[model samples]
Target chain A: MSGQTVANLMRGHIEALAARGERTDGRGANEFRDVSIETGLIGTAEGSARVTLGETTVMCGVKLLAGTPYPDSPGRGSMTTTAELACLASEQFEPGPPREPAIELARVVDRGIRESQMIDFEGLCIEHGEKVWVVFIDMHILDYGGNLFDCCTLAAASALAHAKIPNVQHGIADKDVDLPISCWPISCTFAKLGETIVLDPNHDEEMVMSARLTVAHDENGNLRAMQKGYNGAFTVDEIKTAVKTARTADKVLRKALKEATK
Target chain B: MAGGNSDIKFIKKGKRLDGRKPDELRKVRIEVGVLNRADGSCYLEWGNNKVYAGVFGPIECHPRHKQQQDRAIVQARYTMAPFSVNDRKRPGYDRRSSEISYIISQALERVVMVEQFPRAAIRVDMQVVEAHAGTRCAALTAASVALADAGIPMRDIIPSCAAGKVSDTVVLDLNKEEDNYGQADLPLAIVPSTGEVVLLQLDGHLTPDEFEQAFDMAYKGCMDIYEIQRAALADRYGGSA
Candidate 1:
């Protein structure tokens, strides 16, 4: 979409929601929609997760590959994200080349995991600057209910946590070792709709939302990363509320992660 | 069924395995609306083999020439997901997928009421998420349920099942091992109400009587699957499947 139309449409919704003091979907300031996650559902993939953020459906799969680590981070592993805006989802998403919108979505999701230090990149190093562990995280959008950044994060993180690296068999001059992953970071999103900040915005809500925020947290309620959407300015008060609400949700999210491990 | 193999065996105790008295089927389960995006979608687990199907159009026929004035054309493609099998299957077309797609499309075309849509096309995408045995039959059966779930009109529901020969004895619903090493396999797709076969594929050696026996076994297996198909359709949109 062109910059002018996107800005105009979003700016108008921002003003309307702000003046109303409530969400168009009737959600409270901090209440998240009922979010249910199911893991280990797909028989394929080392680890798989399906997350439905309201109506937006996202599925993530983690595939391991042998590769050389970057020159600087030779001792660490890496993660790559790919998003497909399938023709089945919406007509606006054309088949063929990955459009700018898809690239942006992948980058946004990649930033949350990369910046947060989700994986122990160093541990993935097989031989410094040589052979290393490459974690390929593929994100698929089954439905477009909106808030893909948060939904993809939730799905990717859960799939990572549930992922099991196969027992490695290699020849480093008679030395073989099994790779281990210590932690998986989880990402959750918050949206500022008018005066109200909601968790897990639905598709319609996303269309009408003023600004959306996403934060990645670890099992210990530690902040790993943060991002905001819509290029809107938020007051310090709104930012504080988002952090507080996310931290609270972090506890439940952690529990959800643990239960998902089973 | 083979004697020495993997975690799950198809034969045990000098008889067809999974505790079926030679002519038994694997446990079958079906669920509709498995995929929220597709107009109609369903998932099925016929024992270890799992398949998912979605029906998308009947909307518009593209490429112009494919359109018809009197009836809609059924365009179906059956694909296996990359991670669907034990060894990753590359996305897109393959010999096995193409063959299955042809058979599934032919089977579906027999029952779908194409006249209703006129110049449009009803596209059914069947994905085998996991493959054990009887994948084609399972895919065909699940696709009909998905089509029904999507509320597309059909002359009749197409149900399919495979009956094969193992250790000189015909067994119903061959599992993964039975499919690979069995003597003969006959996969059949039938319309229960009409009692007419729309899909018929046979591989391996079987005498005339043996073929008759296998066909009967497969027919019973189709009926077994039909119950689940009916139940799944009934759960969504409300009606007798």
Candidate 2:
């Protein structure tokens, strides 16, 4: 993939983008690319949604099953998060072990959801400490460009919100019923590159960025969790700015999630 | 498999559980030019089933050994996000998905003019975000829009669909219940221009009479889906008329 690097002008091209305080794709700092979301398109899954952030496309599906909750959380239901890097995304991602990068991506996505209390695990309990429903969120990055964190988070949350648990029974009247879930958690990710803070960086900015920050918030617009990627220390002022930005972004994102699922 | 014992009422009053009529199809929406890095990409929603497809390459084949001298290779992968299934499928490849991937690749091979790009490969990547009953059909259909969105040349964008029988009733498109209880299930890939079945699969029991009915129903489905496919492609490709 690197052989076509243009050999020399690479640095100069990126320098132009940095100097102008703009992305190679013409996005302004703090501006996100146009986003569209849709839900209930996948009938096979319990719930599913697809989020497109510019060219960074990610799809999320939520599956439900009756199983014993983890021992540590016997009273509450269980949740799991995983990511798949399809060969269709990029040549860089091969079909195996998912690579360490993908694992980190999945964990960051998981932290945002778990911290948000989005699933309402108590509601999933079929029996107290006996049987319960486990929620599974799978994130698949079908295309690679830039800024997957925000896109993936939104997809997962929307999928969860769009999901409907089936009514099951053991031939007992009281045990079987339809359950419609309420509430949701959504995330906003910001990238800091070359002293410019950008929202929804494209594939190019992601390729040569210093650090990226992702923050998840709930329907109430309260911060649920945060994860910083690419290893860089943050200044007090930068952290404050990021928090403020994330808070404001949370409101807008929640609406998007709702619209996507609706 | 949980058999005929479980109680699930799929249809009532000539309407499905979801409130759709028997002949009516789910609402399908599509968007192209998604995933800017890919050669072509599209996202589609058909009722509760969502599919994201990305078409890359006809550029280069890695491992260098996979490259050929005569024509391009068409490779496809169909995967469900772990959350896409009710049981939370373990994240990895599976037999059913692999089978779909292979069939989809072969279906595409016929439409794509691969000989134009020797020693190259075009990849069709499909991800199912939500699984209703007809994900393979939706994903394959979305992949066609994606390939066209990328400006790739094809005989015609492929139209895919499924038809099944429930309680001796042949249906146009099987919802979750019809699929599960269907005496026979047939999923197919069709090229709308030719009305040909490039990929076909069947399970359960179907007499020769039922098979023909399912095939005809599936063919009609392809034509129905083809209208949406053509409109989407034309929107991006510019109006010919």
Candidate 3:
């Protein structure tokens, strides 16, 4: 069969399964896949974490360097997020500069961490406006099982939590210090299959899903970031339900993140 | 471990710094078909280096001009993650990666029977998630297995290994510290059956006698690696091949 025909068949199969309140992986609509997070896996980086959401795996590394702070945020440290969806992760990802999917993944993960104020940026300043710590968060997609947004965000947040300022290396201080983390923000992703929204869609489910929604919540249950993906639209009721699902899902993730970082 | 290079003893007595003999190769572990989305993939951990290789293709070539009328084009891209080394590498392709990618493509192309698929393209992507030393050899070895796992026809599975001179002794495989302070480095890829040297790269300094010894050591290392490659494939295919 042609590729599209096979996709259509899979889509039909998924919709049929969804209507029965089940997923292809035999999980409930609100259930998430197994998540395992390991922190400090990359020795070179100040902090790093490897997250596995089911079969999908992503590695996030935090590299801190001393540089001139931005003029707009002079007293605060700066953070730049970048995501690479290398061809090694999947055949669909080509070898080139960052593409749309990668850029989108980075931005969504960035928004969750930055908007949540998870890192105490002001404390990172070495000198009033001259020199400050700049943190680079790099998200590398090693395996594309699915639900990359949530996985990337989790990896980034965990890595940030594990990060320490390389003060001695940068000649800013006599010893290293832990990054000031104020809050933990966890993201949950869901895909709409026909009329049903499934939490943490795997690769096949993502390929056939109509729309994607990712919701990030902080420790206090405040929604910090939201992203709507794909060309499909969701009903107002579906949006409300997604937020509720995300809030509940983040509880498990936050606990896992804490354990991993600790 | 600190101060001057000469102060750091790369070799002591009969063993190297990591407590291995000069001709010892690091422990290697290979797992094939690790990625579900790729046509074929392999995850390799050699010493402290973690590398993944994925093969995609024999598909129609993009940008028509890049296609060859008589043979498929093999394009290999080698990338190191930002946190792969002691210092974080900036994201994006750099001169070193470009050179390694080119050399890897040339090496794989020699063994892959590309002429059968005209106007097509085969892409091999090698990502180094962790690096100690000899990443190029590990990447090439993994890529060759990934190609075979993808069911691509080839003259033979290519295995690569590196030997370098440290503390005036030619070692079979150099680790991170040895690579940093080693006198000479020689990385080579060979077709075990045909004994053809497809890839050869050298750096540092070596006497003619030392060069021959290193070459012999590297070849032996490759032959050892070739057996592991075959076992990996057999494990995946139930020993049919």
Candidate 4:
């Protein structure tokens, strides 16, 4: 049989099971797969984290470097976010300029952090109109299941939250100071198959999902960023319900980030 | 990057900067069948934003390998003119345009009856001649009308709009200033018949209650846009007044 035939068959099976409120892994609709976060994994980097959500694994490294500030925002520091999705992570990813999926992943993760107002960009400034610390968050995907947005966000936030600014190395000061973070932003992803919506969808669920929504919220239950993906539609009620669920899920993910940092 | 200027007031005395109510949408006008050579075409003007959409093919799939045996693939390319915004945008595809193109393609594929045309491809091109915010929603809404003008069968026409929090209040169909200075923005597209959302994206800060209010506002805005779309198509097809 052709690849299309196989995909069609799998989609049919998944939809049938979804209609009955069941998943292949026997997880509940609101349940997330086993989540684990390990921080300070890379010794050379200022800070690093590895997060595994079900079968998906992503590693994030945060590096701080002193550089000239942008012309417009001399008093504040800046951040550059980049993601690498290579063939090693999944067959679907190719070796080229970052594709749409990788780009989207990086941007969504960046928005949550930037919009949350968590990072104190002003504190990173060494001198107005001159030098400032530029924070770079790099995410590398090691495994592919589903829900890379949440994994990447989790890893990036954890790595940033625990990162130390190398003040001594940059010659700004003799002692290193912790990266200034005011809050933690947590993102929860949901997939819609048939009429059912499930949180933290696995590889199979992602493959068959008609639509995908990722909602990010801060510790105070403030909605920070959201992105809806794939070829699908949802009712207005469905989105409202997702927002309510995201508020509840924020606590669990925030706890994970805190525990990993500790 | 950082939040916009807080000094600029977007709402005062229950009216917006444009002297409109919070629930009112910006002035909108859409023209269908604008292109002579294309199978279908549409031009849309919403506030200061100007967008054009053209549809072509159900033709033979290119490169051969991408063609599916069972169904046609829908390809949508969203691009912005260099002079569209306040700053000159770099020409050609960028990360932002690529992502927007992808989501628009997905939403179009859902409505277009692609399975009816085997081993073929439908190309939809959207160009933002001017942008003042909400260009993606405008482009997608225009493309749907262009598809209809091309005589393509669809499950339903999709209408798109945005609702956002400006001055800590949820308002419908935010204009450029409101979008930039607002606390949050939610762009949504819905199939009016089924009340199903085809596209949704949100950014900035909002509480759970604020999100609900914005969602409701945007949903109603989409319904209003739907009526306009139907009327535009009816005007072209000589339907009932």
Winning candidate number (DockQ): 3
Between candidates 3 and 4, the DockQ winner: 3
Q: Where does model 2 exceed 4 Å of error?
A: A1-11, A16-20, A25-54, A86-97, A116-126, A142-145, A154-200, A213-228, A231-262, B1-35, B45-48, B169-171, B191-197, B220-224
lDDT of 3: 0.89
State in Å the error of residue A85, model 2: 3.8
CAPRI-wise, candidate 3 is medium
Which CAPRI tier for candidate 2?
acceptable
Model with the higher TM-score, candidate 2 or 4: 2
* Model 3 lDDT, residue B47, Cα: 91
- Comparing candidate 1 with candidate 3, which one achieves the higher DockQ? 3
Give the alpha carbon lDDT tens digit for every residue of A1-262 in model 3: 2233556679988899998999889889888889999998777789999899988999888999889999998899989999999877775676779989899999999999999999989998889889998889999998888899989999999899888899888777799999999988989898989988889998888888889999999988999999999999999999998998788877778888889987
Query: Cα lDDT for residue A39, model 3?
Result: 90
Which residue ranges in model 3 land beyond 4 Å of their true spot?
A: A1-5, A171-174, B1-9, B235-237
Model 2: what is its DockQ?
A: 0.42
| Displacement of the residue A222 alpha carbon in candidate 3, Å | 0.4
Best prediction by lDDT = 3
DockQ of 1: 0.22
- Candidate 1 per-residue C-alpha lDDT over A1-262 given as tens digits, one digit per residue, 9 for 90 to 100: 3223454576566547645655546765555555667877666576778887666777676766667888887788887787765444442343345677777777877876776676777767768888887777777666666678777877887877776654343343354333354655666677666556677666555666677788777656677778777855678897887777787775655666677765
Q: How well is candidate 3 docked (DockQ)?
A: 0.62
Global lDDT of model 1:
0.73
